[model samples]
Target chain A: MRGIILKDLYDNFCIPKNAAFYIFGALAISIGFFIPSEYYYVLISGVILPLFGCCALKSPTEQEESSSFNKLLITFPNSKAQIVTAKYLLGLGFVILFNFLALLWSMVQVYTHHTIRLTEALRIWGIGISISLLFLAVIYVGFFLLGKRNGTIFFITITCLIAVVWGASSALLGIQTILSCSPGLVICLIFSGAVMIVLSCLVSIGIYSRRYSTGTKNRY
Target chain B: MDYAIQVKNLTKTYKDFTLDNISFDLPCGTVMGLIGENGAGKSTFINALLNITSAQYDQVTILGHDLNTQIKLIKEDIAVIFSDSHYELSFTPLFVGKMLSKVYKNWNQKKYLDYLKRFGLPEKKRLKKFSIGMRVKLEFAAAFSHDPKLLILDEATTGLDPVVRNEILDITREYAKGKDRTVLMSSHIANDLDRIADYIACIHEGKLLFIRAYDELQNNYGIINCSRQFLDTLSPDDIAAYRKEAYNYRVLVSNRQKLKSVFTDVWIENASIEDIILFYTKGEKIR
Candidate 1:
């Protein structure tokens, strides 16, 4: 667990592209927030981060490093579960950090009259991160379930399906009216988001194990 | 004592190619050079040992641990270095120092710095911009910094200029400072392996032709040049493989002395690993 965090933070994120990712994320999120749009920032960050993140995972150039690093990680004196946990935890850590930063920036917007109140901001973050995690979940499932090639395509397809569903559902049932009067909406959304994140994460774990077992047979 | 690596009935079937029943062993503290063409399954073999992709685990074990259940333990003692640079090549070397230090339990900062100085790599320069030789040097430094007992290298020494290749070879030799250390390397540059590898395993078209001590392979294997009339006098069983080219006959033999018993027209020449591989895989011209 310690090993994965150290590698992800130090080896992966301390360089040029990493800074670019955070900087671009901040810029993209800021643009969405200041635009006075309906779920624009939330939607953009939700769709873009996961979409690009999956692309990053399957990047051909990244394979040179990933395969080697993964080789090192598997060989370490730890369980695959531990390695998986560490990687997910690191992903979790980064996502949480991004959430905090996103919240802080949103708070600044609220202070300046560009965004919603504190409670609304909290709800937005909760929903936003859940959507992003769903994207991540799809990415994980793709990598571990179908191998990198099929996985990227599957992830994109799933993301597109979600977008289509969201658009169609929103057309039929407006989001603002549902949330305007009911306090229960906030609690239900939180519970739903939490359940989705946990379920997606767990499904990814199952995919990862099955993938490893299959890989073990054909590789040797 | 059992060999460090033990593979029994190991097989992998790809759609187009099959790595069929591959098996070999390296005694502890010895270096084995895996020689093969580009698609000869060298990387596949290394990947299998590391348990990277889904590969057979029940039949292969290293360092006395079950490959399936004990891969992590094997990996802790074993280090792998591929030709590609794994560290952030765009950061200062110091960043590499910090990044790798935390992951490896026995990470030695002083040792890393010493290797940097020894390899003549700049500490402040970003690695992505370094010369290929320097990048390779940095990779070796990091792999060695961790106190690993086995080093599995997949063409890690390929493409470097000769002098740097020699330097890398020397550094690999130093990593074996302790008698218990071992290295398994796959290289196209036979000269490099010829200098350092104690054992040689030649793989071609997903099959292992042979794995033997470097000295024995070099000493026992030879290319016997003979004429058509002479070839007619010799039997196929007397030679490993004989080719009838336009002007002459090139015969590969396991024992050079066998040439004397053949027709007097036979001319036996000492064969290098390259010669053995070329003749074995492509059927080199005897003339």
Candidate 2:
């Protein structure tokens, strides 16, 4: 399992060019938002954080298709379920790594400028990461079930779901109810995130097992 | 005889095609060549053996283990190479070697590196930059590095140049020289199989047409070129296929020894594997 996850990371994230582009792009984007100094942290975090999640969502499947390596992956000694589990775990790893880095950077900014309170930044980071987790769970299930070709359809469906959730919660309950950083709300979010991860993991494993067991699609 | 691969009543169906009840056995320590025209279920047959695709089977076993139930255990000792390279384009030989080291328990890093050096592949060059032949060589290197007991190659040499194709065939032949090693390679290039395979299995239209020893085919099959008038005197049962043009008739005989006395005046020559395939697939059957 460690080897499998390592291979996935090696394939998707080990490129120097991609690393440079993301890092430099984030720094350049952050510096470009200089007009409003007070909004610097918010702008940078908003742009880079979701981009990180999207990258996490997109990398493995896109690389699997373009490289034609997924066909070879099944030929490995690992079981089908193991491969799916490794992928989900790799995604989780990425989510954790990205959110942690973002939190650390936010801490540095708060330390230097003191414009944002530590708790406020922590809450924002928590909410953003939780939302990213939910987003990834849905994307992971879609990619596993429909494969790479229906990626656009999956993205559209996810976008619509996000929009519906926002509209319904904001209209019926209140925006504050959804955005509040209460302990109860945080616990609820964590439980739901855990549930989504577990459910997606199982479904993805089933999807991959059926596909590989039947030898249906060779590339994906 | 101890068989390395024993497939029985294997069937796979698509909307328009069905590999119906295919069965054949490949003995241990020998190479078996699978030959077929496009869409004749050659790839499907190979994929079924690898369990890369699911097929209905009464029983399928590889290396003494059931392919369906014990594939995880079986795969450790089996190596497979498809027609195209199945590696990431961005990966170099060094990276691939590192990745595979964890996948195969018997992976020999030294052997893999030796293959890379022998194949003239640079350790740091990305696979996307390698020529098609080089990419295939990389795949072969990886396959060989694991020291698998059974190698399943599906058209692995199809698009390679003659020199590279011959080299690949030689590698397979050497790989099968071990005490228990075996190979099942599929190709339309019958001459390649003729040079290395111990047995040849021909499939046509999703059916196993014939699975015979290579020596038996060489000894029994022959082609006779004679006048149309002389062909009329021969029995149709002896003629597997025939083509008539102008004043002559060319007949492919399945039992060449029997034809010697039956067609005493006709000149018969040994049939090449290519000639045999052409006759079976394209020539008109005598009866």
Candidate 3:
């Protein structure tokens, strides 16, 4: 499993081409610091960071499919469970890294500009992490079930849907009003995201194992 | 005699085709050459043996371990090479070595580096820049570095130049020097098999035709070219397969020496592996 994760990271993250994404992400967060406090969370956490995370999340699957590495992966000593779990763990690692960056940005705002309270910033950070987790869970399930070609279409469709839903909710309820809700709601959202991720991982394992066991030609 | 691989009643079905019930035991310390025509289930059989595809089987034991229940243990001692490289194109040979080191518990880093150096594969060069021959050499380096008891190659030498192919064949011969290692390779190139294989296994249209010792094939199998009257005098038991030409008939017989002595008027030539496969697939069956 560690070997698989390292391969995925080397293929997708630690490469010259992917350096562009990191540069773009950093630039987006830096620009968000100058925006107003209420809009800062929406731009940095909602749009830029999740969008960046989604690209990062989709890369390894695409590369694996293109290179037929998944076929080779089945020959390894690892089981289907370990293979599926490695992808989820990599996603979780990305979510934590992005969330950590968001937290640091919020802290700088709270100390330097005195525009947002630390407590409110923490609340937004928690909500952002939950949303990222849910996004990761859905996209991974799509990649595993639908395969790489159709999964790319699914990814684009889901991204558009999320954008539309976020836009409508922010317009109707306003960002401040939604954030003012009880902390219990954030906790529930985070727990649900965790549960969904676990379910997604299991589904991926079953799909992968069944594909081979049934003698269906693996798409990857 | 001990065996490295024992497969029984193995079958894999698809919507359009099926690899029908096949069974064979590859003895230890010998190279078995798997020969078949296009879409003749050569790769399918290799896939079944490696568990890359799920096939219904009564039993499959490799290197003293059950394939179904002990595949993890079995995989640790076996290495597989396909016609093309399966590693990501962006990966350098150095990265592949590092990644495989973590996957195979018995991976020897020093041996791997030595093989890379010997094969003249650049450690830092990405695979996208590699020639096909170079890519195959890299796979060989990795396969040997792990010290696997069984080496399975599926069309691994399909498109190489003669020199490179001979070099690779020599490496396989060297790898099987001891009585503890085995090699099962499938190839369309019959000459490659004739050069190194200890036994030949031929499959035609999802059926096992024969698995004979290399020496037995050389001494027993013969092709006779004669007139229709001469062919009619031959026994059906001696005729395995034959093709009728415009002027004469070419018959494949199992007993070359006996037929040679009996038929002084006809020309009997020693049959190569290619000739046997051609007759089996394209000629008429007699017995």
Candidate 4:
């Protein structure tokens, strides 16, 4: 499992070829710096952070499919459970990293300009982490179940649907009202996201194992 | 005798094709060459053996371990190489070595580095920058470094130049020098197998045509070239398969010595592995 994770990291993140992705991440961070403090959490946590997290989770699966590395992976000494768990662990690690960065940036904003309180920033961070976890769960399940091309389409469609619904709800209930109720809502989201993530991991392991047994090209 | 790989009643079916009930055993300390034409299920067979593809099998035992219950343990002692390199293109050989070192318990870092150096592979150069031949050499280096008990190659030398292919064959031969080591290489390139194989298992249209000793094939099998009238005189029991030409009949006979002694005037030539495969695939059944 450590070897598979290391291989994925080497393929997707720790390589010079993916320097462009790092630049994109830096650009997302820089873009967040200029947004109004009141809307900072909205833009960074709601949009930019989830988008970045999704890309982080998606790239390794895409590379594995394009290169047929998954076929090679099954030949390794690792079990199917180990292979599926490694990807989930990586996704969880990225979600934590993204949340940490968001908190750090939020601290900078709070100290530099006293617009948002630290406690409020923490709440926003919690919500952001929850949303990212849910998003990761959905996309990971899609990639493992539907494969690369269909999975990408499914993810994009789901993202668009969520955006449309979120926009409609925000317009109807108002942004300030949503923020006021978010403390309790954030807890619910976190609990639901954690459950979804666990379910997604188990489902993915079953899907992957079935693919090998049935000789289906589910991911590869 | 101990077998490195044993399969019984193995079958995998698809919408268009099926690898029908096939069974064979690759004895320890020997190279078994699997030969078949394109789309003939050589890869499917290997995949089934490695549990890469789910297939129905009554029994499959590799290195004395049951394949279904103990594949993970079996995988640790085996190395497989396909025609294409499965390593990440962005990774340098140095990084690959580091990554795989954590996967296989028996991975030898010094031996891996030695192989990379010996193969003239650049440690820091990414695999995408290397040629196909170079990438295959890298895979060989990795396969050998782990000291696997069994090495399985699926058309691993197909696209290489003759020189590099010969070099790989030499390395494979050396790897099998260990008394416990075995190799099961599947290739349409009959010449490579002819040089190194101890047994030849021929598959034609998803069926096992024959699995005979290489020595028995060389010494006993013969292609008889004779007129139609002369062919008619030979017993059907002696002719395994035969193809007819414009003016004569070419028959594949398994008992060359017996046939030669019975018909001293008939022209009987030694059957190469390629000839045997061609006769089996293209020749009509004796019946």
User: Which one wins on lDDT?
Assistant: 4
Candidate 2 residue lDDT tens string, B1-287: 39999988888888999998888888899999999888899998987887777888878888899876787888898888888537878888898899889889999999999999998999999888998889888999999999998898889998999999988888788888888899999998888899899999999999998898999889998998887777777788888898876877788888899888876776789998888888888889865
Candidate 4 lDDT by residue in tens digits, B1-287: 49999988888898998998899888999999999998999999998888888888888889999888888898899999987537878778998889889899999999999999999999999888998889989998988878899999999999999999999999899988887899999999999999999999999889999999999999998998888887788888888899998888889998999988988877789999999999999999866
The all-Cα superposition gives candidate 4 an RMSD in Å to the true structure of: 3.2
Real contacts recovered, all predictions: 0.48, 0.53, 0.47, 0.55
RMSD of model 3, in Å? Answer: 3.1
Q: Write the per-residue lDDT of candidate 2 for residues A181-216, one digit (tens) a residue.
A: 586665577678778889988988888877767532
Instruction: Name every residue pair that clashes in candidate 3.
Output: none
lDDT of 4 by residue, A1-220 (tens): 8898787776667765565786777796787687656665555765567656655556677778777878778878988889999888877877887777787777876787665777677777777777888888888999999987898898889888877866886789776665566688888998999999999999999999888873321121
For lDDT, candidate 3 versus 4, the one ahead is: 4
* Candidate 1 CAPRI classification by DockQ: acceptable
Report the C-alpha displacement of residue A132, candidate 4, in angstroms.
Answer: 0.8
lDDT of 1 by residue, A160-218 (tens): 88789767755777655322434466556556655765676677666655544423543
Better of 3 and 4 by TM-score: 3
The segments of candidate 3 whose C-alpha lies over 4 angstroms from its true place after superposition are: A54-57, A214-220, B264-266
Estimate, for each residue in B182-205, the C-alpha lDDT of model 1 and write its tens digit. 899998778878888899998888
- Per-residue lDDT of model 3, residues A21-55, tens digit only: 67776886788778767766655864557555655
In model 2, the runs with Cα more than 4 Å from the true position are A28-51, A109-112, A116-119, A149-180, A215-220, B227-237, B261-265
Query: All models: lDDT?
Result: 0.68, 0.79, 0.83, 0.84
Model 2 residue A32 CA deviation (Å) reads 9.6
Give me the runs in candidate 4 sitting further than 4 Å from their true place. Answer: A15-17, A34-36, A157-172, A214-220
Q: Which of candidates 3 and 4 is the stronger one according to DockQ?
A: 4
Q: What is the TM-score of chain A alone in each candidate?
A: 0.69, 0.74, 0.89, 0.87
Best by TM-score: 3
Once fitted onto the true fold, the runs of candidate 1 whose alpha carbons sit more than 4 angstroms away are A10-13, A17-21, A24-84, A98-183, A205-220, B228-238, B257-267, B283-287
Residue B127 of model 4, lDDT score: 87
Name the 10 consecutive residues with the lowest summed lDDT in model 4 chain A: A211-220
